[model samples]
Target: MTDISTETRSVVIEREFPFPSEKIWRALTQPHLIQEWLMKSDFKPAVDHRFSFNADWGSVDCKVLEVEPNKTLSYSWDAYGLESIVTWTLTPTGTGTHLRM
Candidate 1:
């Protein structure tokens, strides 16, 4: 019998930004801003929405999983035989916003 299986793991990166959640949220949801920092994408902060992120090298197939204005965005990333979920969360902080990825 041929066995097909895949292993999954979670990766979390956290940082504190001196910027308000609203500002950071704009950069995360706005295609133009995302293109400046990440890649050219048709991303929308809409759940169940499908999008593509493109680059000079290649592109990745993605689907939005969850979105909470100024709070969270989660999606599926599939490319090069690897599949992963990336979730970004922002929380109000005394200093500014706490960003997690």
Candidate 2:
């Protein structure tokens, strides 16, 4: 069989929330808070801990790779046939939170 390889592209999603940086950071990092908006169920965060979410598209399993307080977070999105790193970075604005992916 011929060897085939694919290049992975990173996706960047930017959003501005009216909440403070700490609040936005908690929504992104804290499992319970995340579930309230983005997830269908509970999520746990620990090194190598797998978290599952049931969405309109389908079920997705992601493993926590790294976590940094109020700044950076990295996880492996393991669903379908695609495995990629998803990172979230939060920046504090004068009166709100700036989120970058």
Candidate 3:
């Protein structure tokens, strides 16, 4: 069981990575790398691509909304009786790239 709130709002998360955007992009779009951090499934970077993230408990059905190489990536996350859009923005900073989720 999980808490489900009626009110909806977008949650933003930001992190500063001490590496270039290409490296981070690979980790984000690559299925193997993503599975290492997120879940096990076939994930691609093509626009409108539908994929799933599978775990022991359940899975999430997602569709790619937007994809800009190493710049921005947006997708739909639906599961557990909830649906939300998750967008990741990578901005090049002075020393590294700033990743926002």
TM-score of each candidate?
Answer: 0.91, 0.80, 0.91
| Cα lDDT, all candidates | 0.93, 0.80, 0.93
List candidate 1 segments past 4 Å from native. 1-5
Query: Per-residue CA lDDT of candidate 3, range 16-39, in tens?
Result: 999999999999999999999999
Worst 10 residues of 3 by lDDT: 4-13
Question: Model 2, range 1-101, lDDT digits (tens) per residue?
Answer: 98868976777999988888888777876767887888774565566777887778898888888877788888877788878888888888887888998
Q: Roughly what TM-score does model 2 have, to 2 decimal places?
A: 0.80
Prediction-by-prediction clash tally = 0, 0, 0
Candidate 3 regions off by >4 Å? 1-6
What's the candidate order when arranged by decreasing TM-score? 1, 3, 2
* Model 3, residue pairs in steric clash: none
Which is the leading candidate under TM-score? 1
